[model samples]
Each structure stands twice: as structure tokens, then as C-alpha cells.
Target: MASSTITPASLPPAGQTSNFVDPPYIGGKFVAVNCIFLPLAVIALGVRTWTRLFVVRSFRWDDYLMIIALLLSCVLTGVTLEMLNWGLGKHMWDVPLADFMAQFPKLNLIAAIIYCAATGFTKVSVLVFYLRIFPSRNFHIAVWTIVFIAAGYSIASILANIFSCNPIAKSWDLTITTGSCMNRPVFYFANAGLGIFTDFATVAVPIPWLRRLQMPARQKVAVGVILAMGCFVGIVSCIRLGSLYTLLKSTDLTWATTDALMWCTIELNLGIFGGCVTAIRPFVRRYFPRLLGLSSGGGYTSSQSRSRKHGHPLGSIPHSDRVNFTNQDNQYTTTLTTLRGAPDNGSEEHILASHPSGHAKDADGTTGIIRTVEFDVENSSTAPQRE
Candidate 1:
């Protein structure tokens, strides 16, 4: 029997696959899971974009960048994984996914590059948003500075992933029959360190910036919660670090590294999601009906949300009640009233006396004064009777 000689066209040795790897799924649960995740993310990307277009009335460049990046990354990662699977003769869980993934480090580069590119851009967009929205210059500087550092790390990552070797091909293909390359360990270690820093910076930048927002206390905290979403970013970075060996040596690190890649994808998507959340927060207050409260049916407004605690939703003050009928003082008043009371047949003095002190009519009928000693009850007893 002829031995299956290895060639780029021929599949790798059967059952010699790595258990897990990075950036792309190899087979089994990895393939099934990614099949689900990619479609879901695609669906989410579309739904989120459309929802923002009509409901929020706008979508930012970051949104477009993130959606496009996610799509490209997902498609590349998925297609590459499928091709690798076919190359390996649909190798199953007999070996690690890393064994297969290691076969094409170039694909790894592509996957990680797209993931990092989207994430880096998303973070920068978030920092820009913070700069625009936050009142504190310190917050702006802090966020931008972190973004600057992240940008540096991202650039390092790009260069490292691309040119760490004399010729870039060596980083991906061991059988290139070409120039010698840098040690894989050295490249991966540096990658791990840089990734940790980028992930950390991505997590850290939003805090001070979000905390500095002039929103309500709860909302300020909510804004700060955006940074907390980085928990997944850190998780993926750390997990990949722990599995760095597989990321480096394994051929099919699909399941292991693909999870990491997917996490990174989600992290960037979440950042874009956070932007949408922040931008429409005020709009939510403006247009959305408060589920648990009453309104003059004019719908919710910023003032109603401000006055009422969140345990209850919003209630609007009627337009007539928003201002005082008589401007005795420059205070805001919300008392609904009717102008039903007219001059009685009593003496002009007594008829005039029926009106409250500030209720005296002006020439234009728009403004009035009241000078009456007695008044009829109206909508609420506290509300002045309408004349």
C-alpha cells in the first residue's frame, strides 16, 4: 500500500490534529458552534443597523465599520475553516482543532487581523464619542490617551503579525521552502503581551470618560458599565494566552482559538452596541412611552423622567398646567385649571372681587391677573377654576 505522502494539495496525517487552536474553528463542536455564532452575529448586525436607522434616526461610521468588519471576519474565518476541514478530510474530534489551524497561519493572520482591526476602530470610535459627549476635559484626555495607547498596540499587532519574520510567509507556512523565520514562541509571547495590553486599554478607557458624563447618577453608572463589558475581551485575551502554545504549535486550534476570535468579535460589536445605547438614551426618554406611568398623552419627556424615579415610568404635565395662569412669581407651576368663572351680576367691585388677586384680565386675553377673594373649584381643588 502506498503511504499518503504529504503535500499542500494532500491532507495532513490523519488523527494528528491539535485539540484546540486560535482564530478559526477546526471541526466538531467548533464548526457547529461557529456555524451558529456567525449567522447569529450576521443577523444581529443587520437587525441592529435597521433598528438604529428607523428608531434611533441615525447610525454612525463606527457602526458601519464594525458591521462590515464583523461580516468580513466571520466569512473569512468560516470559509477558511471549512476549507481546512475539507483539506483534512473532515477531521473530527480525534485530534485537537489546533493541529489543523496551524496548517494555515496566514488564515490565522487574516482572522485575527480583521478582529483586531474592528475592535481597535470600535474603541477609537467610543473614545471619540466620549470626547464629544463628556463635559470634562480630563475625561476626554484620559479616554483619548488610552485610545492612543491602544492604537499603538494595534499597530504593533499589525506589524508583528505581518512582518515578525524576515518574510511573512514563514509565520504561516512552515513548508514554504523559503527564508528562515523568527521563533514562533517569541512572536506569540510578544503577541500575548500586546494583546493583553490592548484588551486592558480597551476595557479601561471608557471608565473615566463615562463617569464624567453629565447624565443622571444612575445613567452615569450605566455609562461606566460600558467599560465593564470588556470583561469578555479580557476573558478571551487571557484564555488565548493560556492556550498560547496551541495558538502557536497546533494546526487545528479552531475550537479553542475560534472561541477567542469570536469573543473578540463580540467585544467590538458590543462597543458599537454601547454607542447606540448611549446615543439613543435621550431619545428613549423623548419618544418612548413609559410603561408604568401616566401621561397627558403627549408621551414621555426629559422632565418627566427627571422628576419621577425609575421605579415608576414617566408622566407628562399638561401644557396648561406647565405654566401659571398668573405670573405672580417666576416659579414653574403645574396646576390644571378651567376659565369657566365669569363676572357675576353683583356690584362691579364684588364681581371683580370674584377673581383672584392675580386673575385680572389683560387687554390681549393671553395674560391675566388674579384679584378675587373667593374662587370656584375646578379639576383639582388646588387648581384655579376656569372662567
Candidate 2:
């Protein structure tokens, strides 16, 4: 084997050097974190795909976006593990300078770009999910705004990282010192700051709507917590910020950034986890119905699946109900009535049926199911009688 070309001057600065012979190889921690989280995220994604593709049977844009996020995350994981071979988690001075110069900067650059894209896609996937469920125009606008901001930040961050050094190749080549590079510390700080903002935005946007749901308070909180899993990723991002600052400021690049890199890997995996979790309600509702307070055969069924099996359009009355109304007057009156005076279970959907004059209208007509009724009046002067 050829001898390494590393020189004494090429080593990390004396201030960053340690005297310990086997200075802690923290690569195991990084590896362990990735080993644990990536598989969990992948499992979550797998369950999500099963839920959306087979159980819920309503695969859509958000699902596709999450798939992309997971793919990028896998790539990022591979890159990080590869960087470990080049002394990523050891003290800088402990590493052969030739090895450090050969690969670390280049791999770090690729990881940054991958992280941005992965996280962005994950957030947008969750936002698109909001678009699917919430018909509120204001909520849609808010979701779209966050989507654009996340996407734009990803694009901008990727561009900034790619062109951090003027001559592009200068990013990996420390020997070429003539080229101008962006203030990377400042750029990173800004990127992390904006990313945290979007994280909070994603976690907060659906809260108001969730609180307004008619479900019990406990279930609502559970749902909110599940959907807001990204907040934990945000919290991880916050913690990663400190590590990032340490790496940016320290002379010990390899050792100082290990924790930050680990957190970065974790953040992306958790983003994948969060993006896939909320959609797994169908899976839980199917296999573990008790968790959702539903019976063995009963849980959430998408309108599409219902339509396919029952042959009725979404929001339209079924054939069985249609037969009962054929003999009534052509004039039909539609009114919204509450579930009050009726049995109230923990069901998620409420059906409103039209009735005679005494029934009150719902405050929000768009919510719940609406049933139309036809009235036949035998005598105009008398009070209406039930058929």
C-alpha cells in the first residue's frame, strides 16, 4: 500500500488537537442514530403506503411527495455513512489530512443539499395533506404559502450550498485559497432559522381547525399531537443549530460537527416519520381499531371506497334511501339538524337529515353529511305529520 501524503502542517490547529491516543470515536453514536431512525422512518413509510394504496385506497399527491422525501433520506443516510470512512466523527487532528481533504467537504456539500430537499418535500407533503382535508379557503391559502416558502427555501439553500465557493470546485479543495466563498456560517444560520419557522408553521397551521372539530377533547389532542410530530423534528432542528454553530466556529471540524451531522440525519428521518404518520390513521383504524375507538369492522372509510362498493357518488343519497322518497311531493326542502336528541357516540362523521318546520339549521352547513327529504301534504291547513 502507498504511504499517505498527509503533512504535520496539514493537521488540525493545535488548539483543536487532543493528546488522547484513541480519542473517542463517536461514529458509533452517529451510526446508531441512523440505524435506529432510518428503519423506523422506512417502516412508517411502508405502513403509510399500505394505508393509502390498499386500505384507504386514495393515494394522492401528498403520498407521492413523501415517497420522494424518503428516497432522498435514504441517499442522505448513505452519504453520511460513507463520510464516516473519512474520520467524520473523530477529532480532526487524528485523521490523515489526505483523507479529510479527499472527501469530507465534498460529502458534506452533498449532504446539505440532500437534507434541504428531503425536509422540504416532507413539509410540503404534510401541507398538501392539509389541503386534502381542510376545505377552508383561508387554511388552503396558509398551507400554500408555507408550501411555497419551504420549497423556495430548499431551492435557495441548495443553490447557496452548491455555489458557496465562487469556483464551485473550490468548496472541496482547501489548497486553492484564492477563490471567494460565501459566509457559510451566516448562510447556515439563516437557513436553519427559516427552516425552524416553517416547522412551527406546519405544526401550528392545522391546530385551529383541529380544535374546532366536534370530537372529544382527548381525541382531538391525540390527533393534534400525531399530526404535529414534525414539531419534534423542529425541536431537533433547534438542537442541531447549536451543533452547527459549534462546527462553524470550531477549528476541529470533524469532531465538532459529528453531533450536528447525526442530528441532521435524525431530522430528515423524523421528517419522513412525521410526514407518513398522520396518514397511517387508516392503518390503525383497520388493524387496531380499538386505538381509534372503532369496532373491528368499523373505522374511517374514504368516500371513494364507499362509492366504489355502494355505487353512490360522494355526498349523494344511496339507492336504498332513494326508494323511500319516490312517492313524495316533487318539492323537497333541505335543512340541517343537529345530532342532539339522538345517540351521541364518538363517531367522526355526523349525518344531518331534513325535517319539518321545527328543525334548526346547522351553524356550518358544509360540514357533516346532508340528507334531503320530500314532504307530501294531504291538507295544507294541518300540521305536518311524519310518514
Candidate 3:
């Protein structure tokens, strides 16, 4: 997507040179895409941060990494916009040779570096978030391996772009014919191919574990939808690869590379947006329960009450609230309380009430007598003791 000067051989015959060049109108498209999508991406990130810090109250490493990714994305957007002013989105012959050589290659190198950093941290953030929920040792190993590969590729891409040409300055200053440069088209294709592969791998990693969770069908589908947003990012990566092909084959560099630049921006920004989607579910479920058709009274059912009455362990019930029991006048009562938010470690605490007689049984032949009541608590750690 970088700009390049037209070689002398590309020029028209001396007598046929025209005074005016037709505009391809690429700058407007670049500006329009940035104006529309960048703010939405930023807003999504903000909502996720608020949910993690204030609602869940359990911010972790993934949140920090996403913040870094968002920051780098902002830089990428700003630099790319600046590039339009430096002869981007114009035919190479339309641009003055001095202006094209002075700004195009240097600015392109900076954009590439930022792109690698942004994408690398974004994938790492996703894997780190996965680590919090999935406890399988083998899954952990697999996620960490992907993280390492992502980091290594990002570093290598940055270094390759920085040192692509001998005497580095020669990459921008074409006057220095004594230096040589790597085959840039081959490098671009390889880097983009690896990126697309990792995108698909990340999308697939969480599916099996999510399916194994012991939750209701409705809940599982909700979780799956959030994780599957990565598939959209993968789709955009494929589109970007095609655009890169067009860019590499094009001799009218600035005019033809607009599609490539636009898709690159979209792919990275959407990565940030998709990473934020899963973290904000608590906020949606809390303030907008009706949006998902969740009942306001915490969705308790009669069977759950009966299970508590018979002294059933809380672990046997899927997605049940924390419960406490009390014994009085030869009778047992159960009190259920909801935790303020889902715990990061997926563990819950329960309190079971027992009689001093040690051999008591209910009239129905149940091993223990119990009754059920329910309430909500702001913090699981501060839940009330049995009275």
C-alpha cells in the first residue's frame, strides 16, 4: 500500500505529456472510512473498560493489553490520514518526484511497524482472556504457544521492514543505486498469510471448551456469539490479502493501494472492537436485562427451591445462586443470594446448615429438613451468615 515514484520508462513520450491529470478520488474514501468507524471502535473499547473496572471489578492482563492495542490503532489511523497529504491516493506521475521520494517510503515503514504492534497485542489480549475462563492445562499450553508465535512474528515483521534495504536510507532515497533491497512483495505475502492463519486459529480455539460448559442452551449460545465475533476479523483479513495482491501488482502505487490501506485499517480496528465485546456482557445483562429477555427477579424457579428444601448440594444445580441455610425450632430454612458479578475464577461459595441432633430426618424421608428464601448481595465475599 506504500507509494512509489514512476520510473522514467513509465512516462509518456515527451510531446504527448498532458498538463492536467484526472483524479481517482481515493483520499475522500480514506477520510470517510476513518471518520465513521474509528469512533465506534473507540466507544466499544470504553464500554469494555468501564465494565471490567466498575461492574466486574476484576480487571486483568488482557484488559491492559487491549488498551495498548487501541492506542497503537489510533496512531495507525492518524499516520495513515497524514499520508494522504503526502501524495498518497494520487497517481505517481501526478506527484512531484521530490515529494514522493521524501515522504512515501519513510511514512510507509512507520505505518507497517504500528500495524504489527497493534495486531500482535490484540491477539495476545484475546488469548489472555481465554486463559481466565478455560482451566485445562493442555488448553493453557496451546494458548501460550500461540501468544509466543504472535509476538515473534510481530517483532520479525517490524525488523524486516526497518532493514529491508541496504543502507536503509536507500529505501527512500532512490538516488543511491549502490544499495539493494529485499523482494518486498514476497515478504508482504508471507506476513499476511501468517496473519490470516493465526486469525482462524484464534477463532477456533475456544469452541470446544465452550461447548463442554454445564450451562443452559441459551447461555451457551450467548457466549458462543461473543467469541465468534473473531470470525468477522478473520474474514476481513482474507479480504486484505486480496487487496495486498492488487497493491503489489499495481504500478500506479498511490492510486491503486487505497483499497489495501482501507482494508488494513478496518481489520485492525475491528480486532479491537471484537476483543471488547465479550468483556461487556455483564453490563448488558445487568442494566438491560429485558434486552436479552432475562427476568428482573433473578430468574429463580420452584424446582430450585425444592432442591434446597431437601438439602441438595449447590454444586448439583447449573448456574444457581450461592445459598445459605439455617436451623430453628427443629426446622431448616434456605436463603439464596446472587453474587454481584461472575467470578473470574468460576468458583462459588456455599453454606450448609445442620442440626445438633445429628440423626434428624424430614417427614418425607429426606435426609435433612430445609426451606428456601432468596436475596441479592453486592459482593460474594460479604454474604451474610446463617441466623
lDDT on C-alpha atoms for all candidate structures: 0.50, 0.74, 0.72
Predicted candidate 1 versus true structure: per-residue lDDT over 144-229, tens digit per residue:
67778767776766766677566677777756776876565556556666767756765665565444445455554555565565
* Model 2 regions lying over 4 Å from their true place: 1-21, 216-218, 299-387
Per-model TM values vs. the true structure = 0.58, 0.75, 0.76
Query: Scored by Cα lDDT, where does model 1 land?
Result: 0.50
Candidate 2 per-residue lDDT, tens place, 1-387, comes to: 112444421354545554234656889999899999999999999999988766665679999999999999999999999998876888776777777888998998898889888988998998998897788999999999999999999999999999999798898888888879997766877898898999989998988887676765555666867756877888999998888888778877788778888988888888888888877776776678677566665523322232221122222223344433334333222323234323222124545545555453333332333332223322344434659
Supply every candidate's count of residue pairs whose N, Cα or C atoms clash at under 3 angstroms. Answer: 43, 0, 1
Worst 10 contiguous positions by lDDT, candidate 1: 343-352
- Give the Å shift of residue 67 in candidate 3: 0.9
Clash list (residue pairs), candidate 3? 334-371
Q: For residues 187-295, write the lDDT of model 3, one tens digit per residue.
A: 8778888898888888888878877788656666777777677988988999989988887887767666667778888999888888888677767766665555566
TM-score of 1: 0.58
* Candidate 2: pairs in clash: none
Q: Between candidates 1 and 3, which one is better according to lDDT?
A: 3
Q: How do all the candidates rank in terms of TM-score, highest first?
A: 3, 2, 1
